[model samples]
Target: MGVKAWLSKPLAAYVHKKHQSWIQNPVEAQQSVFESIIKTAQHTAFGRDHHFSEIKTHADFVEAVPVRDYEGLVAYFNRVKEGEQNILWPGKPLYLAKTSGTTSGTKYIPITKDSIPNHINGAKDALLSYIHETGNSSFLDGKMIFLSGSPVLEQVGGIHTGRLSGIANHHVPGYLRTNQLPSYETNCIEDWETKLDQIIEETIDENMTLISGIPPWVQMYFDKLMQQTGKQIKDIFPNFSLFVYGGVNFEPYRKKLFESIGREVDSVETFPASEGFFAYQNEQHDRGLLLLLNSGIFFEFIPTDEYFNEKPTRLTIGEVEVGVNYALVVSSNAGLWGYSIGDTVKFTSVKPYKLIVSGRIKHYISAFGEHVIGEEVEKAMQRTMQKYPMVELVEFTVAPYVSQDKGQSFHEWLVEFSIAPANEEAFAKELNAQLQKLNTYYDDLITGRILADLKIRALPQGTFRHYMKSQGKLGGQNKVPRLSNDRKLAEGLIESADALNTNKN
Candidate 1:
């Protein structure tokens, strides 16, 4: 191992120890950490630019830098197109990670050579921590399969940015790179169908010891494998030891995967974005998701309720408390200072800084004045599933829409199932009832009968794949959107839901 790798273990140890202490004494620890980050941000590439140069201290950093949405990013990209070197940060970045922006279209997030180490190191710590937590070091010995996005990079007016999976593939050591299932260089540019076919062919005979990627793609791969072999996943990859996933919640699909595979697999959650890898599942899985506090990034949190309120307050890692939802913000070496990624997280425990993702700040349904968040939907679904234990939900999504004649808004549920209840209508009613009970706002809407619709569309086995295929977004970094709040996107999703219902009948 190189010097950095050699030093990483000790660094990881130190960070873990310090984080434990910080969690214990949150206020003081938070101040110290925030001050250090502010200092770092002011001196690094992020600080030297015109946009960030004006800020000098932690308070100034928070106040001067306005909270930005996708539109702000689009404006930055316009500068990038104009050959402006530093819109968000100083320095000519090495590459850009292309991601589908929620609203303002596609985004090309700048990634510098200095920033890549943060991602690699954070991922390394995540894997090491998982090993320590589960006491399952055997996973490291096996061939790990990562279902990533296309590796192809497109040069837009001489600026390079490709899908995140492709970038990760290209950055891996050459020796380990050969072990990867689909060659990133070839697969990144290949059509989705061709790529899926290649993935199926590669994994058919290989001993895939560990599988990692977005949940939806993993599901699709497993489904395809089962169809091809007529054998359960357990029969095919008996040695499969781990399932590492991120990008979306895995709870809904967890039971179904276990049922199909016939065994429990060790699972780890990763929080990575185009900007950088932020957090990972730590040694104490119960403590919550571990933030990569030492990843050359300054972290901040805005209380969930304060996000929409004017002049929202920011909290440092040390100041965050358990059960409080906060919008995650980061100032990274890659030049994004005080950037909010739109993810909302709740600290499960304060002592260890363990957190669970609550939901995306933008991804919620409030059509009928009932503000339903991702967590609310997840809890409702979990309760419904508990009530009806026999049926397995393969995939599900929730959207808010209004009935034209009724002039009242309600939630519509679309569920894809492998095994549905004997009485579908009764199942739907029970699910709706569970949801109403869990969320009072939903209950009020239902009681008033203002909630005009509660629809469940059971999809065929491969229905979800159609959306992934149509978008040309599968594997690796791309994830199936769970909760869509945007009206236009919801409409497109409804079309797919309708198609699935049509196919079933």
Candidate 2:
């Protein structure tokens, strides 16, 4: 082990012990965080508007601040954009995590001085937690690559504004900075393809130990590496032991990733967003991520079933039950109050409050009253893929396909396969069967003759990548939705696939 790796072991142990104190008393930790955020921002514009001064309890908070998404919070965000200090948080925000918006063109989420630690520490703790558990600090000796956005920042309301990953790039710890890969100029390349190529060139021969990225992008890097050198990732980076990923489920990509690496390696999953770093996998063997209770954010859970109701039941950490899907609402030091980031999570353990991200609130399909979610589709796909080992998935999406000819509509699965299955019909049938088994409503729709069997649109490889590139969302935290109620994205993907086929013919 190198000097830093040797030094990290003791530090990791200390951090682990400190983490246990908070883990053991999650409710208390949250209560403390809630109080701290509320008290600190009590005089800010949002705090004053929401009567944060008088709020003393979670109930008071629920009454004072209504749950709102980005669109709902745009008014205050507009003030912040226009260089207004104390509009959301006290003084001025340290940075704005600029992300793509749905209805709105662009979203500028504030990253306050108080909230910045949560983002940085959350990532720090994940790696430290891994070190503490496995006693494998040697990986820290090799070069680490975080496949991320450019570190380039632009002025927005006099605040440094960039993608969350880019903003995070500025704060990579000094110790790790020397070990971090893909030189600053390479990272600053705007086009994802160019950046990716540059990254491969920079790190291809380095002693890359830790690789961090979303599953799809990382798979692209792996694929590129194999094509460039005709060598598996394990051969290229013999010491590559840790695969740190987030933004999407790793299960679907697990088979392909391991195949590319030529062996299985330890992986860590994180629950991070532009708003806050909510959770991280604390244990190597554990199933769920440990929700960060003392991360300068207060979390609320609105049961996903009742989330659409006018007055959804919002439960605090003390009240949430295991296995129930709940939309995650957060009030944080960043001056966001009762903000719903649209993520849905299901608690697996209440003892230490570990949860799995279920899906997104808006990223589901209920077009035919079959309320299918991302988790359901992902689970089905995973199971089916397990049975068909040869079928390596590049990417896939599910959307409702309404028949215009008065025929029954169906759920469409647009899949790009790196290695297609031998029997395409059987693969589609098994995939549909798996989905039906997971979602009773979808099963009912098929059995009741209300909908046709889920159709598989076997897209040509690189179709999803091309589609994403066309929309200018090629990389860095941008992921294709797992489920869509409407066919807007599905139609575009279909068109792209058709174009590719036409060009080939």
Candidate 3:
């Protein structure tokens, strides 16, 4: 057996045992996780303050530790930051996963010695499970490249701080480290342009077989590789067989990635966050991730429809129904207590427990009471793309333009297209119609004359890339906001496009 594959046997065994525990009875598995964490952390301040010692059941646990967003946990985290042990988790964390959310700005998420194993071993099992099912372990023999953030982490208080990918990379097994690409020095380059160049130069001639990154940055690398080598990805590395991705909806970029690679390859989708690694696509035919019930992260769901009410129902694994949108609440060994991660999801299956990410709870555009969401917008774009053969989407964001001068308001879409539609007017009309059909409030606003027809501004090619680069968020994991409550992002994108055109002129 290949050395990497040989090293994966133990992980495969772990996944086998864990997957059985999950699917046999998901509710029971999640209960086991909850009890374990509560028992371990009962001595901590958060546990004692919330009376976790007296909590004997899931319902009691929920009542003890109220569901909280990052803001609610900040006070407890501050104590941990000040070199306090057993404040949130069992001990002080060794590293912090620094996250600058699109709206929430910078947040330093904790990563503890107890919690780090969940991230590492679970990640290892995800790959091993994919291999066990696909029987495509030969790819492990060739170079595997993960396009990640800078490995050079900054010290925050007493802990090392960096992006989650960089923190995870630090714990990469010594065996797999040999097959990994891009020297540590290359990965530490702060400037994405410099790092991309160095990675391309270093791995251009390697016998690469596996690739992993978010879709957008991977697309960027593919574009550059094709441009420099004058060859498709398949031609460059005939053995290139796997592409693993996460952190954004992959459907929009699927066609582009296929075009770049020039052939179909096996792919695995994972749901990972600074909080914890939650789920992954366990079956090839089943795209919905098998929820990691046995993982160290305990899961709860508050139906989004009822979330804003005064004390909405929090459903355990036993209560969740397929097809309902729920705001995911998590309590992980990583020291978070009943934390709302802000992302929303819909369960696709309830028996074995699987789900697809719906959208972020805070990322919808409800200007003028239309209440449009990211999923609706994405579906609209997908529907339009089906009708227009000449059009390809790069990235898009929508914002309301309220002009006091005219006393009217409309959504202004800043969209960068790879191939311009043959008829922009018709394209916009159909897209608007599709969205109208999806959300009744949006249609009512248009019909009631409360909002004008959507305005589309076709951005120049590379506008989104340029905008992202300008913000120093050119890497994967950081996505351009799809829908904004305000015009800040829309105006910034428009300004960036204008600058690009001005330079060209």
Candidate 4:
């Protein structure tokens, strides 16, 4: 056996043992994690203020800390950004991950030493879990490429701030450094298009065994690779065996990705987010990611339907039931206390505690993995509407046009305009461009034809009112859903609007 192949046996063994122990007594494991974090930060301002000394049990902890989103945490984060140590965690965070949050403003999530290991070790153990399950260790023998965000970190306060990818780029272990693809310089390129070109040039001839990224961006790479070489991905990298993906559902992208590669290969789905490395695929199964029970993060689940209530019930790991959508809450060493990350998930298994990502608690359109949240679309529309001074939007909803029978698939925007734009075609063109500028993932998808241009359908002013009335939800805090993953809401609006035209005749 080779050095890498030999090394993996021990690695896989370690992951299996740790995972086994984690699932065995999850309740005590979680309680221990919660206590460790609270005790470690007990001397901090937040700890003292919350009277961490009196907190001894889960009930006490729950009562002391309430679930909060970015809005509530931002005050503490502002102190952290200003170089205040022990405000949240024991020491200052070395880096911050900048990402879009529940608000229109950007969020800067602190990344501390204690929290960083969860990202690295969790990823390692997840890959090791796959190896343990399938006996595939040959992947370690060749280069593995991770298509990630730029590593060019910007200095904020006394620390650096960038994407979670940028922070991780600095800590690639020596053992894996030699086996990682896309040279450091190329990985640091700010512009994704330029960086992608360099990655293709640098690793085209290498013995690549694994590829990792969000699917849409990876599909763009695969398409570009095929176009450049006039050969399939399997032909280019005969040893390519694994595809690791997260950030969006893989079902819609699976067929396209397999076609791009020209063959079937092992794929592993994970549930890593900027907030923390939450879960990963341990078995060859769809729609269930094993929860990271032993990670230094205490978890809570709130049913989606009751989340908006003033005092919603928060269920612990022991209390969660399978098949119910719950908004996840986490209290971790990262100094986030009972923070809600906005993503909702449904538990699929109880014994090992597995879950499937359902959708967002916030309304957003991620139909093709673009993750185009409401703030982004709304901001783009507000900017585009500046030129059309006389136009007034009554209501609107966006949906994916994903019919294979239809030649060109696009995002169909059904809008109710009280006052119409001077030129509807010009309005649509400008709106599309604004969206491209707001979201890099959407732009990349558009460039690759993974998605087509945005199309607008104008409706009369009362279309929204009529549609809502049909649903018996008229006029009392009742609003149309702004976005949808499927065509149900969009089709309803279109049909309702068409009936208005028929009546006008």
Candidate 5:
């Protein structure tokens, strides 16, 4: 190890020792964070309107604030966007994280000075945790790259605003700044393809060690590099050791990513969003990401089955149980209260509050009441991949095929394959069998013949990327929905893939 890597081991040990204080006493840490944020925001407009002063316990806070998604709280966010101070949190926000929205067009989530550290430190400690465990921090001496959004911020109502990743770029520690790659000018290129080309040009010859990004984009980077240089990633960057990823599950992309790299590299998964930095993989195991209890965000969970009820039972860390899917809710210093971040998680370990993201509340295939979720499909796919070792997938999505005629309905899977399985029909059957094993409701439908066995439609290569580019969301945290109830996205994928194939021909 280099001097820097050698020194990081001691620092990593110190950080891990400090983190144990909360990891051991999670409930107390959560309670402290709850009191701190509530007390701080009590004077703000939302707090006063919700009777924050009268609140003393979790029940009191729950009664004072009703759980709401972005649509329900847009009024307060609108006021803030129009230059209102203390509308949600004290004074003005430090920055607004701009994100694409389906109905709202664009959302501006507040990131206060106090809350930003949680975002920065959660990522930092993940790396430190890895170093503390493996004592391998030599990667620190080599170049690192975080494929991210443009760092250019646009002023919104007198506040600096940009994508969450872009906002995070400005806060990278000075120590790591020298090791980071893809020049500022290159990152600012709004288009993903251009930015990626520039990235390859800049980092191809560097001793790259760590690469961080959402899996799809990183896959694209690898694909481009291999195409350009005719060499696997390991050959190009022999020192590369760590891969940091978030936004989506990694299992689906694991095979292809490893095949591209030509070897297995240690990786850390993080659970972050515009709302807050929630969790990170503290250990190099499948134990699940460790939830942040001492961060500036207080968490709440509603059982997924009860999320749509008139008033769902909100469970605090003390009440949450392992193996139950819960809709994640939060009250954060960033001025979001009883906010549903649209994510569903299941605690894998209640002691340390380690959880795996299950799926999104709005993104599922329940058209026939089977309620197939992202986690189920991902697990099913992982099983199928294990069964068919030769198969390699680029991307896939599922949607219900509701029949208007007298024909039986079924689920449709659109998949893009880099290495197609030997027998497509057999591959589809294995996938369907795996899905039935994971979801009993789906199994019942299949057995009863209420729904036909799921159908697989092989999509042309580059179809998903082409579709994303056509929609103006080619990179920087944009992800294809894993499952949808309706056929809107399914139909679009078919059309886009057909068009792409035609144009190529």
Candidate 6:
């Protein structure tokens, strides 16, 4: 075994021992954890005198702290940006993790030292879970590759902030850190073209044993690698053993990734956010088990129905059952209290807390496992649409449709434009190509001709406004849902697009 592997085993053992205890008695663990979290929040300067008062009991604490969306946190951080200390946690925040927000564009999320441990311990649990599930201890030895977000820490008003992926890279254990690839912190490039090129240069001829990242970004890298080397990923990284990914669903991208690599490798799905690493794929690749950061944060789950209507019912870890979707709520040392990160998950097995990511409770769609959420589709569309100056998109929505013939499902993109392209068909084709290129699962589904259909409808300039008005949500906080997974909602969007087109002509 390599030196890294030799060192990792004992570390893994220690982690597993602690983890087993928590998993075995999740209820007692959570109750004990909640009490400590309340203490931290009550005593910490950041937590004291905030919106929430001291949570008396675990039950009252969960009840008092209502579930919050991204906007609420953004508002809190904006206060922090204006030199307001103790917004979320005690002391000055170490840094902020910038992420694309659903309604508020780009968001700056605070990360404190207290919050950092949650991420670290969560990652450790993820690694240990992988080892236990796959029965492969060799992964502990392999050089791991993480296809992460741009690591460029932007200096916002003298405070450095960037994506959590980048921040986490800077915080990994020093001894375990490898020099095989360009450090994310140093090789920071936001431009996809420049970033992909840099990544190619760094990864070339590297003996990477594990790969991790968001699904689309990783697929993009794999496609570029194949084109440049003329050799499949398996040929390049023969030692590759595990494909670890989080942030987005890998099911849609799985077949394509496996095809390029020539075979299926051990895959682990992690549910990590700027706030915390929530869940990790266990020994079984089928479902991700919730490895609650008992030492760092307290967690609650609100029923999916409650979240959709903006009513939050806080559920303890012990109370969560299988087959029911729940919106995750968390309170951490980082200063966030009863924060809802907007992810919807369903428990597959309660004993070990194995859960499957159902979909985003807001702003995403996942039909046939394509998992094209709002932010991802928007980013890809923006990047591709910008390529052609003539193709100006005022607004758009991607909704899933089921064909009447065989009840087969497909994605219909409804785009409203200020000006129509001379080559509208070509624009549509290119849009599909860009989506496929960015995410291989979409590419495979489109190419293999498995999905029902991929259609694009271009409407008049004010079509979006008309549609929004019809829905009685013309302005303010309401925006077009990027990925409309609901069949009825998809059909409604299609009708609106048709109505706009009819009015234009």
Model 4's lDDT to the true fold?
A: 0.85
Q: How many clashes in each structure?
A: 4, 0, 0, 0, 0, 2
Per-residue CA lDDT of model 4 for 62-102, tens digit only, reads 78888899888888888888888889888899788877554
For residues 1-505, write the lDDT of model 5, one tens digit per residue: 7777888999999999998999899889999999998899999999999988888999999788999988789999999898899989999998999864434546789998889998899889889999998888989999999988789999988899998889999999988888988888998887676677899999999999999987756877888899899999999999999999997656646887899999999999998888989999888876599998998999999999999998899999999999999999999999999999888999999777899988778777755546577877888899999999989999999998865444566899999999998899999999999888777557745764557899999999999998898899999999999988678888889999989988988
| TM-scores for every candidate against the unseen true structure | 0.67, 0.75, 0.74, 0.92, 0.75, 0.75
Q: Point out where model 5 deviates above 4 Å.
A: 364-505
In the order shown, the candidates' Cα RMSDs to the true structure are: 14.5, 14.0, 14.2, 2.7, 14.3, 7.8
Q: Which residue pairs in candidate 4 have backbone atoms (N, alpha carbon, C) closer than 3 angstroms, thus clashing?
A: none
For residues 1-505, write the lDDT of model 6, one tens digit per residue.
7766666667677777877887898788887877766776565543555424555776666455556776766667787666566556655678888765545656677787777887877876787756655556675575667666556677764567887877887777776676334565435665555666777887777778878776656766787798899999999889888887776555656777788898778877777788777777766636656767466667788898877565566788878888999987778777777788777888888877778778777766655545455766777678767877876778888886643333334678877777767787777777777676555446545653445446777765777787778899988999777767665655666677778778778
Write the number of the candidate with greater TM-score, choosing between 2 and 3: 2
The predicted structure with the larger lDDT, 2 or 4, is 2
**Alpha carbon lDDT at 47, candidate 4:** 88
| Total colliding residue pairs, candidate 1 | 4
Q: What are the clashing pairs of model 3?
A: none
C-alpha lDDT of candidate 3 relative to the true structure: 0.82
For each candidate in the order shown, give its overall lDDT on alpha carbons: 0.67, 0.87, 0.82, 0.85, 0.87, 0.70
Relative to the true structure, candidate 6 reaches a TM of 0.75
Q: In TM-score terms, which candidate is top?
A: 4
lDDT of 1: 0.67
Error of 1 at 138 (Å): 2.5
